[model samples]
Target: MNDTTPDSLIPYDEIVQEALRAVVGRVLGQVEDAGGVLPGAHHFYITFKTGAPGVSVPPELRARFPDEMTIVLQNKFWDLAVREEDFTVSLSFNQMPSKLVIPFSAITAFVDPAVDFGLQFQAVEEDEDDLASAENDSANGASERDVASRITSSEDGSNVVSVDFGKKK
Candidate 1:
């Protein structure tokens, strides 16, 4: 008559997150296979961890974002290269051309506006110490852009599909 849910050793959230990231990889791979052609007005908005390990971007952009940032893969992006661990693409920001290399582990959200299909993830949360450090850094030097992008988009009425299996109290 044990009715309580036992805590399993398996990390279900990490496993599910890994699988979902593979979906993003597969979709991007399909686009790569199609010679980087986004089919029939389909465009993607990808949000990722700017400070995640293995992520590479210009210093200025990092200073501007300082945390997470979203990029649109639509009419203007170029040099879409997908690799096993990461993807690199060229995009323009404020008319300045730049290249971004992002690891799959860094991605937190992906959306295809044409189909209104989206996948949102429970991205790795920062540790308390890290959060305190970040807060200190922001207070000392972070800019408006950095503060702006840090805003979460849970209730924006966008077509994002997010799944949260949090326990109820």
Candidate 2:
């Protein structure tokens, strides 16, 4: 009797990740359809990799947050644009108005505290070097782990999707 399990050739992780990202897109699309007005107390905390491909942030912001950044979309946000692969919005940072373009693939965490719903995604790196580079980058004040911890703490009736894959080596 062999205790070892063979790894499947299917890319289930990627498929699942894409499906989860679509959820984010659909939610944003709803907001977009509503003329950028968030009904009631529904707000979002979106965290993404600042250095990821197709990400367009202000130069100063990119310099300040070289690795990851989180933005709140509750009030004071305008020009909300949602697309299939990404979204763009205008937000104010320290009294400076700026527009940010973030792709779904760059998103790492999305949380709506009003409904206690959150989703955390794994950062997809192109190669081991990119992974090492990202690991060495400066840490953000609010990380995916922090978001997950906060969301999971109120686990009574919360809807949080956080998948952890353990790769065999």
Candidate 3:
């Protein structure tokens, strides 16, 4: 047998990413079905690319975030509508209400701290030439800090699923 391993013809990385995104969709759909009320002690911290295609955020918010931003869906959010490709929800930032349209493809991380469950996705690069220096910890408000800390504090790696497909040389 040959010593070197050959790359597969199938696009396994994309396929896996698509299927994993569907999990986020299904979870959001369940919340929508329940009249937008999160179950007891269940909330979400979702991080996504602010500049990604099909993502809609207020001009000011985008200006502040510029690259990646996280949002919390808990007691104050409303208008939770989940569709096949994306989800739209209204959230308050600095007491200013705004609606966000985020495609599942843009989501980088999703965490539910109540159950210690999280999922991290690889961001789709729109322009390789555009290098952003902002950190992914940026969020709209103070509460997101808690979520971010919790995610990074995990030492045992319990329920978080992170997929990284390395490039073939």
Candidate 4:
């Protein structure tokens, strides 16, 4: 019995999760305010679940990244659209242009390597009742983990704000 950790009646985990997700929203909102342009060398690497509901992607992309996919938003990206619950962007892959629409709920990680800042989040399912269920993802030919893994920080690095809801099943 560890007295150090006390249980609470409040759903602290859910509260904190929502708050942290807001951080991503706010940052994107800021970028949208700044004429849809990334400031200076600041760029982003956003990773989200491909099959999560509300996620819209090209057939080839969904085929390439059947489970989780990471996109780079630095120099070549265009049509950066941010909404209340989701964002859409256009990027080129293998010299082929593609558009991706991903809800924040599907995002597992967001990283700005230029600033050495990152955020790791717990991956949730589109269905409430399927939260703990794992799909036999063909993307990587394996079942993806529900937790986001931190990427190795850059040379000019800092700490990543990662959240763990302790809901792993």
Candidate 5:
């Protein structure tokens, strides 16, 4: 008997990533619908590429997080709005308020450390490279303090999850 497997015509990785991001949207939407009271230990830590398209972060924030950033969506967050392709929220840092709008495609990881639940998605093509380039560019253009502040070591070393939808006949 010979083994035969067909190549995938559909982009399963992208599709799964989209669905996973919708989970983020739906979860945030639920919190927004419920007036920002997160249901029992259900806070999120969302990490995304800073330079990805559709990421609307302030210039100061972009300067501070030139490559990737992880945001905690816990008790302090406010004004969350979820749309079809993206979501926006208000968070505070150093007693200063900042608003961030992130598209689903830009998200790389979502974790609820309280329950030890996490989801990691593959970064969109070119976006990953762009993030690396952005970090290099920032390091060259900005002060040492600025570059140092933006560095985050990935404790979870696993890269994005890739899914294949191809099947064997």
Candidate 6:
């Protein structure tokens, strides 16, 4: 392992991150395919970056959240649609229904309260100028605001809860 150069190929960190993102997609897909009832006490608290590419959310929400937002998928949500790169769902806000389209790449955390299972990821950085411009854009202005308003955790903990394959033999 010592002989291997770091730049030789894709890093394991990225590979693991991608794989974990896939888990989010698969979970959402299952909910969509099964007509929306999560079995047992399973529920999810999904936290994602509001300004990430391919994320679609209302302007008011964006303005309210600003940087990152955590959504609970439990008692109320609808129109769940899962795609290869992202997922869309309709949820109520102040009794008004709102739709959100979130890309897997935007996800920072996925937590299931039922079993205290959780996965946290590194927040990917983008070009600062582009992000600033996007924040100023009318179309996503509200979302950017929302992302900024929401609270974010400082701890970027383990990406998976169930397994610890990092142990050396």
- The window of 10 residues in a row where model 4 has the poorest summed lDDT is 133-142
Each candidate: what lDDT?
A: 0.71, 0.77, 0.81, 0.69, 0.68, 0.69
Give the 10-residue window scoring lowest on summed lDDT in candidate 5: 132-141
Give the winner by lDDT. Answer: 3
Off by over 4 Å in 2: 126-157
Better of 2 and 3 by TM-score: 3
Please give the clash total of every predicted structure, in order: 0, 0, 0, 0, 0, 19
User: Please, what is the TM-score per model?
Assistant: 0.76, 0.83, 0.86, 0.75, 0.72, 0.72
Model 6 lDDT tens row, 1-169: 4754445354676788889889889988998888998988998777778888889999998987777677778878989999998999988877779999999999876767565557666665544532322232122123534322221322434223332234243
Residue pairs in collision within model 2: none
True-vs-predicted CA distance for residue 164, candidate 4, Å: 1.6
Over 1-169, each residue of candidate 3 has an lDDT whose tens digit, in order, gives: 8665578699888899999999999999999999998999998888888889999999999988887888888889999999999999999888899999999999977888888888877787645643332244434454544656655546766587877778655
Prediction RMSDs, each to the true structure: 6.1, 4.3, 2.9, 6.3, 7.0, 7.8
Instruction: Please identify model 4 stretches exceeding 4 Å from their true place.
Output: 1-8, 126-157, 167-169
Candidate 4: the clashing residue pairs are none
Off by over 4 Å in 5: 1-6, 126-169
lDDT of model 2 at residue 56? 100
- Which 10 consecutive residues of model 3 have the lowest summed lDDT? 129-138
Q: Candidate 3: misplaced stretches above 4 Å?
A: 1-3, 126-140, 143-145, 152-154
Model 5 over residues 1-169: C-alpha lDDT tens digits?
7688656787776677778788878888888899988888776767778888899988988888877777778778889988998899898866789899999888776656555556666665444344332132221134333322233323545222334343655
